[model samples]
Target: MKPLHLERCLRTVEADKAVLCSAARVPYYPLVVKKARGSWVEDADGNRYIDFLASAAAVNVGHCHPRVVEAVREQAEAFMSYTAVYMYHEPLVCLSEALCRITPGNFPKRVIYGLSGSDANDGAIKLARWTTGRSKIVAFQRSYHGSTYGALSLSSLSLPMRRRMGPFLPEVYHFPYPDTFRPPFSGTDEEIADYHLDLIRRAFADYIPGEEVAAVIIEPIQGDAGILVPPVSFMKGLRSLCNDHGILLIAEEVQQGFGRTGKWFGIEHFGIVPDAVILGKALGSGLPLSAIVAREDLMADWDAPAHCFTHAGNAVCCAAAYASVQVIEEEGLIARSEEMGNYLMERFRALQDSYPLIGDVRGKGLSIGVDLVKDGKTRERHGEAAAKICYQAWQKGLLLSFFSGSVLRIQPPLVITREEADRALEIIEEAMRDFLAGRISDEVLKTVKGW
Candidate 1:
């Protein structure tokens, strides 16, 4: 391993702590990044590591991709940005058309732009409410939409995120998200689907009537909640339920879009098309951009200046986003995601045979999660092991994060090569061995508090 020279990195972190607010931070390691290229990152201390988190799955095409960089450079040279609300730009119009065309939906679609997933999601909620004239919104338990007030009201994933921050948008309701591995119900996947669907049905019948609910927003694969992949039956059932009640179904693809889930969108895996698809993260190839593609008629009534922002659809960001989409298409990264995902999961399954702590390995495409358990029969969560493994992996030149205190988040960029993947697996296996042998200590775990 390259010796860690922490003087520069520590200095940077201390400087950041002096000025930056803690509310905007969720740091897992102290490694300060100086530069990143493709699937690798160089820390301020000059240590190189393979980046498996891929900047929280926002760099699906890999960091600093040539096309994305070139697009940004070209757009910046032409002009920086003007308020898109009043003016028209080629990059904005082109990207809007591209998103409407690629996202799942046969109807005429319109696009709304924003600077982050939270804002786009907030816009979606407003659009749903405006279109249906309903006051209530439905979301799943342990699902994280965003941090903005409207999105935060829809999120129930992190307690820390919601603590002391209430009177969250009234009329918002949350239901259980059917997690197949640690399922709420004791039966099979189909049974679990039925159980959650019944809860919604009963809610509509008794308390929150479906007619009052404007929309049901969900992540096709719950990212922050440990990469939970609900049964196909559950997604289809939810879609049908929304249809029966005239409730708009919004697919939150913030972390799972742009070829991260093997398909263009994660909802495509379940064979269902959402009324509105939220796109962010990988959509902009590291630029600040997010959007929602919905039916044209749904947004026809709500015209400009309603949910507009000053820098929502900046031209340079739109150029980077369009280039990112083109790279995913031309390079066949979507198919590559599937092939590499299968390879990585197969390796993990083999590793699980030797390591009993691994309770479950689940996900689609590059967005996989490895759940660590205390016991095979009881399947109790082993968050400590997850933390130690991540720390050890970092020590050995691999970078990743864990979620819900137990599951190891394994979402690497789609551009990762087989050789690089094998190396990362080796690092993880080494970390696992170290943890099992009591090589990693609690002193190290104290350095990071993972959510």
Candidate 2:
């Protein structure tokens, strides 16, 4: 593919296409991708990039993973789609069993399927409300679940995401989620925990009664909201409160599940078992598939056609998801993620020593973020600077993404080797240093901002 072909593709997109919305936070970097494998992606002009963003984390097992491709291809040959809502499907049952074996919870559990994170979230929350017979729900500020109406109502990540999408689900309340680097409330970890926990306790009296709240939905590692990770104390506080009030707890792991966070689930790091877990993105290794795994009693009563998606439980996707699980386990990608994440963070912190603009480097496992700021003390969000880093990174054959503005997000595929991690990190450091030395162009800086 030539540069002209790439330019033509870009023009065709703008002229012939109309997009209702998007979650990608950076300006579109124009390089028509031709193929990808493992952690490397080749664009139209044959420029290869270390895929740090991993296609919004959908291909965690790596692009065109042989096992996943084989599974989907084999399933497609026999049958493509099946309505599990009506008849039996072996792949669906096998995938359910696999998830049941992996997902937390000692009691009897069941799996409910959907086509995306948003729909799974809706199903999980609806189940919580129905089973518990409560109406109100609680979500955190700067949290993102999905784009659908019910999930959007619970999302506090972006006001633009909810703008003009009026009359969202009632009683969907929001509270500030704690962050270590940003420090939403100033103090030590204990003090931070106490301050945020007190707010939740007060919400019962001031905002909405705790008794009326059906569930408290949260991401163990906040994804779209700059990869924010709350303190363990805060997580335990929520768990205790849920237990005390008989409210259900649902952990939305759409972005953080399936070894993306070094563990089977991000919630595992916190050492608390949620009543339900929402999974998507990497489950089918690039295919669209999401599921809500919960206690048997909670989901055993959800009858079919009550909540139906025509493509839900598609045989090929289920087969792919099952293979993805096997591939992750057989290949030891989970352990690899843990090892590479620590190495990546260490490299980032080393880079931070030379770059003051890199104010904070924090993450567990592969979901890491480098928060750029004007100054360490003032902590003014330098979104432009971060975007400039992304601009330079793309030019240097590295795909980087950021959200909201300040935090440079790095969610590479789990199958990425130390060599790939080092390559991407070197590009990141090189890009940052170049930007600092005034090598970044004014046009690039201008376009990277206010997107």
- Highest TM-score among the candidates is held by which one? 1
Backbone clash pairs for candidate 1 read none
Question: What clash count goes with each model?
Answer: 0, 0
After superposing candidate 1, which stretches have Cα over 4 Å from the reference?
A: none
* 1-451 per-residue lDDT for model 2 (tens digits): 1222356546644553365233544354665678999999987666788999888888989999998889988999999997887788899999999999999888889988999999998887788788888998889998888888999988987767788878999888888888777787668987897788789889887877888989999998898888888889889888998898888999999999999889999999998999999999999888999999999998777766656888898999999999999998999989988989999899989988988998888887888988899999988888878888897888888888787578888899998888888888888888888888998877876445432
Each prediction's RMSD over C-alphas, in Å, is 1.0, 2.4
lDDT of 1 by residue, 1-451 (tens): 5657789998999999999999998777788999999999999988899989999999999999999999999999998899898889999999998998899989999998898999888998999999999989999899888899988999998888999989899988999999888776589999999999999999999999888999999998998899989999999999999999999999999999999989999999999989999988888889899998999999887966778988888999999999998999999999999999999999999999999999999999999999999999888999889988998899889997899889999999899999999999999999999999998889977677887
What TM-score does prediction 1 earn? 0.99
TM-score of each: 0.99, 0.95
Give the Cα error of residue 261 in candidate 2, in Å.
0.9
lDDT of 2 at 262: 93
Best by lDDT: 1
Which residue ranges in model 2 land beyond 4 Å of their true spot? Answer: 1-26, 445-451
